[model samples]
Target: IVTVAGNVERPRNFEVRFGTPMRDVIVLAGAKPDTDRIIMGGPMMGYAMPGDEVPVVKATNCILVGSPTLFPPPPPEMPCIRCGECAKACPVDLQPFEMYWFSRAKIFGKAQEYHLFDCIECGCCAFVCPSRIPLVDYYRFAKSEIWAREQEKEAADTARERYEFRLAREEREKAEKAAKLAAKAAETKAKLAQQEAAKAAEGTAAPTPTAGDDAKKALIAAAMERAKQQAAAPLNTENLTPDQQAQIADAEARRAQALPAEGKE
Candidate 1:
């Protein structure tokens, strides 16, 4: 658990009393009410509690009381000479100079490329900096900006995906319409074919033999012949000899030659 208070004779850790007032803890630790002190968590991350009456909740760690001596006066701000000392002292080993430039210019994207998210906010860079520039604060601002941009990017991607999905749905609807039209055309053609077949069955004056009907009959006859051959495998075609082969060839030639005469008839 985190605890905080001003000037204590003995600093307590893991103090289990819940909803305790900071004033009570200060009194318990023997405070000189006469002395002016600014107590914070640490020199780095902590800020002064507004008053001693403020109750310490779960987050209070250490109340660092700063008199004139406890927290030293801040070093005067000076111009950064681009010296590499702050870069060396940085725990995250960030390029402080480049980040400093981006922060100064408010160029958040470039700062992110330099891995602004990796900064631990140690304030070591500020401490080591000759210019006393708050490098940690810059990293903090950069991180916030990067987070905001990422959220925006995610929103844009979600919007794009929704648009693409809408387009796909529209295309599918168009394709379904086209397929229905094609099916209707095919059904109409089938109805016409059925009517023609019915007319032929009624012995209309039109010729009964069409090329398609002849092809169908020929295929059926061929299938039947193959089936008969398969059923009687021991049949001896070799015994017929060349004369039988010649005769069969002559019959096929005769049929081909008779086609025009048959069509005329």
Candidate 2:
């Protein structure tokens, strides 16, 4: 059921099918000559249609018309005076004046903290604004800006997480490589120690000296004993007479001649 009202010759309800064009509805109702604009719904909450060619949807309950006397152009927007009328008219009990100030100043975060999205955009606050400030428009603008910023922040957060993860992965790889190198070095050191230990064991297992080496060591000991005995024998010749010294010298010369013959033999 489509209800056509305002600036029409016949302001009455009509039963129509779905997807009906707005032009057909207006023609059925007989649009007035002074109808300047066609609104999709009520005058207070409805949106003015840009053209009549748009088809009516299921939600199109009312098709209102606009005229100079019925729906005049909105007054020029003015700055808020904190009159508190918008706050009073707010059905949601929000502070529209504060929202207006924040939105106009582009302080969208503050606007969100004040429950800006909770506003139904009912136009009640704008209706009561003494300064004719478009409070709802400001609220809408703020909401859009906040949403866009949230999207950008989400993207940034995702990128940061990816970068941090990559850094962690690189650190883990480096640590793993270090561990592998350390293990290899330790293994190599253990092998070298084992080789040194094997060599030491082999040295301790070597054979003892043979009989020939023992004979050589005995000869050296005998020669050392003879030298000791000779050193211990005192020089009694120091106190000997001349005849005794001459006899000793003649005996030494004879011993020297015999030593040379033994060496030749």
Among the numbered candidates, top TM-score falls to 2
Count of clashes, each model: 9, 0
Point out the worst 10-residue segment of candidate 1 by lDDT.
Answer: 1-10
Model 1 collision count:
9
* lDDT over C-alpha atoms for residue 72 of model 2: 77
Per-model root-mean-square deviation over C-alphas: 24.4, 12.2
Q: Model 1 residue 62 lDDT?
A: 73
Error of model 2, residue 191, in angstroms = 29
Model 1: runs farther than 4 Å from truth? Answer: 6-11, 14-42, 46-78, 196-265
Q: Report the number of the highest-lDDT candidate.
A: 2
Per-residue C-alpha lDDT of model 2 across residues 172-219, encoded as one tens digit per residue: 999999999999999999999999999999899967899999999999
Query: Alpha carbon lDDT of residue 205, candidate 1?
Result: 68
